[model samples]
Target: MKLFNFHTHNKSENYGIINIYPEENILFGKKYSCGLHPWHYSENYETALSQIELLAKEEKIIAVGETGFDPKSPVNIDMQSKIFVKHIEISEKYNLPLIIHCVKHYNELVKIKSQLKPENIWILHGFNGKIDIAKKLVEQGLYFSLSENILKDIKKADSLLEIIPTDTIFFETDDKDYNIETIYKFVAEKYSMTLSDLVKYIEINLKIMGI
Candidate 1:
């Protein structure tokens, strides 16, 4: 059975979804998601919007983002919010799920979500925060995408795995040079589940989300 990587910057040999660069138009015949990240914000919003609008409709493009607020970024938050709103509109229009990239601006992100009231399923990629914050976000109907960073400390990862809902859990390597199998093994052990079972769970989850 193959692993289902919810968000990866580079294409994987295993069965998983990867992210397509916004500057590129081709889909490359693989499962992927496309969106303009907040850190890459440019003055030319119209150009970015056009590119996203055109590429997001592809059958292979399963989700609508890696876009969201980034408090540490030098780019203006207002600018990031504007682009993020555009992504939400496109995602909702296409009926695709959203893969978010949030930093220290969780509150602002939630505020935008409440205001927009979008229907697309939203998953925050690379989550490595406190369980309290995770609980708050999960309560708000947000999904969590665990990354290799979480594996840096097995005890902490086990603790988080015990708390985060299995149904809401997903995993990814993002841009890291790490093995998804390693992630699966660790998580499966924590949950006392077989690796294949964990892979199947993610597959079912993605299918349910219409990815």
Candidate 2:
């Protein structure tokens, strides 16, 4: 099965993306998760907004984020929520999963989801929460995009993979050096499934996104 990086931040200016000016040549076969990155929001936030909208329309962009609230970041929570809502709307409008970047604000996220009740798929990338917290999000029908940090606690993490409904789970390398192929191999080994089977399962989820 093929592996996918559902939320990569690497974008190049040659691609006409804003805020980020890639310093080096982008690697082959690397699609990305492009967004405003809340920390960089400033007088220039509008620039990122316009470009992101255009990117959302592009078929090459598989997801609408790495975009969401970050409580620890100095950016206003209210503003963050507003921008996030726009992303959620666009993701729904364009039929893309939201590659989320929540930090210290899961409660607010729960509140926001309750209010908006969005239809788009939301994958909380780079997740490292407890089983109860993970269960809570899954119960709300949210998918967690597991990364290396969470994988370190394999016993607890593997238990999550078991409990989360097969379709409601995904894995990522996040920004780590490890690639999705390696992550898939590990997960495939744990699940006693071939790597290709795992890839096919995720490809189905990607098709689910396209639909």
Candidate 3:
């Protein structure tokens, strides 16, 4: 079975949404999620948004983001949010899922979701947050993409997985230098499910999101 990576940074990946920043050159013939990350936010953001919107027209561009709030970023929270909302607009227009990168902003993320009520799917990538926050986001209809951090803390992964429904869950390698199968293997063992079964579950989730 081909293991699906929900989000990743490696441009050479054959089967996943490879994240592309607005300033980067697009490598043709690969699935991608493009956005202007908060870390790269700048005064010329309007130009960047124009570039992102243009890229959104490509058939290979499957999603919008890796864009969201980062309290520690040099950019202020308000500007970060403004840029995120623009990405949301692109996602809505393109009819694609949104892959989010959030840090210490679950409350604000939830608030925006409630306020906008976007019809497209919103996925939180590389999630390693509190279970309560995960549950809260799930309540707001947001999905999650987990990475290698789950392997580092089995006990926490067990608790977090129990609360997050299978249909709302995804596995990714992100920027980490590890095999995606490792994440799949860990979850399969944790839930006492065969790897194939877990794969099927995630595939179903992807379909439900219209990916």
Candidate 4:
């Protein structure tokens, strides 16, 4: 079976979707997730955001983000929150699941999520936070997307996998050079499931999220 890499900037060697920033070079006929990242905040943000609103309607776009909080970034937190909310609005308008990029601001993000109570699914990509935080986020109906960074600490990865419900979790290559198959192999070993079972589990998530 082909591996499902729910998020990544690079093209999939196996069957999976790629994330394309609106400003990046575009190609035809490939699956893509489109949004304005918080890291891209600038004076001309309104202009960029207007463009995203248009791109969100494009047929090739499957999801609506990599956009969310990043408190440690040089970008103003308030601006990030504003733009992130706009992305959420766009996601809702288009009925696309959101792929988030949070960093050291889970609480703030959770607060906004609580206030918005959005119907569309929200996915926190590259999650490596404390288990308690993960539990809280999961409680709020947010799904977690794991990337190759988890492999840097096998024990932690095992523990996180233990806590995270298999059904709400997803694996990705993100922007890393690692292949999605490697992530699948490691996760299957951690869960003591066959590679095919892991694939089936993620496929179920994709279906649930309407990806």
How does each model score on TM-score? 0.92, 0.81, 0.95, 0.93
Better TM-score candidate (1, 2): 1
Cα lDDT of model 2 by residue, 1-211, tens digit: 3356655443432221112221223344445556666665554466666666676676546567777778665668887887778778878777777777888788888888888888888888878877777788887888877766756788986877776665765776555556566666777788888888877777787678662
Local accuracy of candidate 3 as per-residue lDDT tens digits, 1-211 = 8999989889898887799888787677778888877778875689988888888876557888989988766777777878889899999998988999999988879888999999999999999998888889889988999998877888889998888888889999999869889999988888789999999999899888777
Question: Residues 1-211, candidate 1, lDDT per residue (tens digit)?
Answer: 6677788877643466687767764446577788888777766777877777777665657788788878665578788888888899999998989899998888888898888888988999999877777777887889889988998887778778877877888998899868777887888888999998888788778877976
Please report, in order, the local distance difference test score of every candidate based on alpha carbons: 0.81, 0.68, 0.87, 0.83
Residue 205 miss distance in model 2 (angstroms): 1.1
Best by lDDT: 3
Extract clashing residue pairs from model 3.
Answer: none
Candidate order by decreasing lDDT: 3, 4, 1, 2
Candidate 3 yields a Cα-based lDDT of: 0.87
Q: Which of the predicted structures, 1 or 3, would earn the higher lDDT when compared with the native?
A: 3
Q: List candidate 1 segments past 4 Å from native.
A: 12-14, 25-28, 58-60
Residue pairs with clashing backbones, model 4? none
For candidate 4, write residues 1-211 as lDDT tens digits. Answer: 6888888888643356688777765567677888877777665678767677777776557788888887665578887888899899988988888999998988889999999999999999999988788878888989888988888888888878888888998988888878777888998988899999988999999999886
Give candidate 3 misplaced runs (Cα > 4 Å).
Answer: none
